[model samples]
Target: MSDLRDLYQELILDHTKRPRNFGQLATANRKAEGFNPLCGDRVTVHLELDGDTVREIHFEGSGCAISTASASLMTEAIKGLRVEDARALFEQVHKLVTGASGPNGGGPSLGKLVVLAGVRDYPIRVKCASLPWHTLCAALSGGDETVTTE
Candidate 1:
């Protein structure tokens, strides 16, 4: 499993060094901002919907490598999905990172997101890694401006 661990590390580093969909949508239908005070990670997710489908998704923020990369990958994952599907993704990802249902509960299927699972071993980093997903949930939930750990 050492090889797999290295692979996961590489994946996380890649996402951090070169984030995907890291920008802002000119006309976003939905938007949300999240802050992880534990690690001082902050981010904003913006989405443009085209007939219930996310035609565009983007992000702008400053955070740890894990947080930034997570947001970057999140934008890519949810771009083509509907709002509801995106919401489901948020819950799925939340459980994945928190190990709420135990290891491999739902994280292994999260693609690059699974790389972040190692973060569970580090309690403080858990909030860092989860920042993006929290922002996403807030963005999609509507009628909410903030979703915090506090």
Candidate 2:
């Protein structure tokens, strides 16, 4: 268990140190910004949808390691998925991080995202980890307003 925890920590650190898809997308057709007032995490999610598929996705933001890594991992996870699939994934990730379900408890198969399950132990950090995901929802739904976790 300790070894697994160390691996999870390492994964999070890796994504934080060098986040994936951390930039603006010139061709994005949908975009949304998110702010978490509790921890001052802010993120903007951009997407390019080809029909129902996400042809491209990117983000730009400044936040805690959790927030950064979550955004990074999120972009990677949802890139090739359809818009509706991406939305379902958001719910899965939300449950995974919030302890509504566990990796072995018949939750959505999180794959690389399982590393974030430890976040459930630190309730406050859940907001940090999920900031980008909520922003993604807003982006996908075409909501121009900034999503906030108050």
Candidate 3:
């Protein structure tokens, strides 16, 4: 329990137990749906953007601990960041969880997201860590409710 996992244990567990943005945002102007057919983890992300910044976010999903926790953290992380920054953060998580580290050790900007790096050790769980990012991209791009991931 002395590892970085210890540092983020509360963070990840809290998110999983009471996942943030875990509902449908009534005010969302953009929304996207994501599903992991392999694991049957499904979610719909609702986003409210104030120009380039995300003013609010919400989601509803059925997934494993990793997916739920990642979504919770993703919502909190992108609160005030610009769209570009959020996109960068998504890429960071993707690389980190997939074991293909990005430049600068793969997450210089996303501090706690690094906690999920252990997800790389489990290939199946990697998708759980990435679901939110895919949904985020769909929402940002004004896509209709239909996006999928592995």
Candidate 4:
């Protein structure tokens, strides 16, 4: 378990220093901004949907390691998935970060996002980590306003 935690930590740090898909999507058709007022983490999620499939996804923002990594991993996870699948993935990730004891013996089946499971231990940091996800939700729903984790 300690080794797994270490790997998670390393993965988070790696994403923090160099997040994946960390830029604006010039061709994005959907976009939403997110902010975690408690932790001051801000993020913007951009998506390009072709029919029901996510043709592309991207994000730009400034926040803690968990926030950045969550956004990065989210892009990787949701690409090529249908809108419904993306929403399901979002729910899975939300459950993971919210400390829900999932089927994997308390660990959610979020794949790379499992690294963020530890964030639940830090209540405040959970907001930081979830900011981008909520933004993604808003973007999917065609929301134009900024989403806030109040």
Worst 10 residues of 1 by lDDT: 2-11
Per-model TM values vs. the true structure: 0.86, 0.92, 0.88, 0.90
Clashing pairs in 3: none
lDDT of 4 by residue, 13-46 (tens): 8888889988988889999999877777889999
Q: What TM-score, to 2 decimals, does candidate 2 have? A: 0.92
What's model 1's lDDT at 145?
A: 80
Q: Sort by lDDT, best first: what order?
A: 2, 4, 3, 1
Model 2: CA > 4 A from native: 1-8, 103-108
Model 1 per-residue lDDT tens digits across residues 21-118: 88888888888889876666789888787887888889988988778878888887888898888888888877877778586657455666666677
Instruction: Report lDDT per candidate.
Output: 0.78, 0.88, 0.83, 0.84
Looking at model 1, the pairs that clash are none
Stretches off by above 4 angstroms in model 1 are 1-8, 105-109
Of 1 and 3, the candidate ranking higher by TM-score: 3
Model 3 alpha-carbon drift over 4 Å, by segment: 1-8, 102-105
Quickly count the clashes in candidate 3. 0
Better of 1 and 2 by TM-score: 2
**lDDT string, candidate 3, 48-75, tens digits:** 9999888998888888888888998888
lDDT of 3: 0.83
**In model 3, how large is the Cα lDDT of residue 92?**
79
| Cα lDDT of model 2 by residue, 15-79, tens digit | 99999998999999999999998777899999998999999999999999889999999999999
